[model samples]
Target: MIDPKLASAAETFTLQCVINKRPVSVDVPPAKRLLCILREDLHLTGTKRSCDIGRCGACMVLVDGKPVNSCLTMAYQCQGKNITTIEGLAADGALNRVQKCFLEEGGYQCGYCTPGMIVTVTALLNKNPEPSMAEIEEALSGNLCRCTGYGGIIRSVLKAAEQGGRRHAGRHESA
Candidate 1:
């Protein structure tokens, strides 16, 4: 049996965090994961929640420009930090290079995992613009794709790094 009183009490807290370059303050539970906060509270559904654990990369998001699993991260952990989701990747309706690459390479199938994959790759490329194939595999090691065997995703990322990355190199500084 669930206790409504307890659940409600557990569902509320004071949260102060920066999301997508905007300062936001809201009341949420301390134990609620950032994934929940983003999807439910802030309404940033781009960050998907899968596996309910860190095993799946569907919940990946940028915390201070580094990839982190939102499902395993508590809302409070995002306090006073900058967080970016797939929605933030495109500025003024312009897709980021990584996103463009994903599209060009058909990096998505079901598209459920694309957001997390894109976020993870963007962070990886930000750290190393010219990462080797091995490095690319290593960087994406944390992400899992049930559809493609990573050949297409890796190729897509490489293409993005080589082409659009140059343009983004001068702008859209990582992190």
Candidate 2:
């Protein structure tokens, strides 16, 4: 049960983007948020949907290696850009250093916000391999975790940096 006019209008705009090193083209409404496209269309649900107003970083993803709030980004605006979701962080059945550190450090409690936290830390560590405690705090300010009290998460980031995670940070590959 759908309207033909609205469907046609939605089909008018096609978004072409590179996602996790793979080229993808999908027909979408011009005003559709990139979040919906990723979750609904592309089925990349690793990016969580919380606080849809952009106050929460649960929907964070990487655009051209920079962290962006996918909920606030329009699908049409992602044309020809590189988009990386949490699913892209691993390679060859191996978890990246950041993810491993998060696992070992007990960074997650409920695990709802782990994806965004890991993605943000990946971008931060990519830019600053050996980030100070203050730098880590500043980078993670936008993300909110209701569980685990952030102590384990901070330790995970610091531990990843100590393990030389910079090599894997910001490195996106096909999932």
Model 1 Cα lDDT, one tens digit per residue, 1-175:
8799877767567888788878999887787799999999888888888898798799999999899999999977887899888888767778887888889898988888888999999898777777788888888887889988877898899998897566566444543
Looking at model 2, how many pairs of residues clash? 0
lDDT of 2 by residue, 28-91 (tens): 8888999999999999998999999887799999999899999999987898999989988776
lDDT values, one for every candidate: 0.84, 0.87
The runs of at least 3 residues in candidate 1 whose Cα sits more than 4 Å from the true structure, single-residue gaps closed, are: 1-12, 164-175
The total number of steric clashes, by the backbone 3 Å criterion, in model 1 comes to 1
Clashing pairs counted in every model: 1, 0
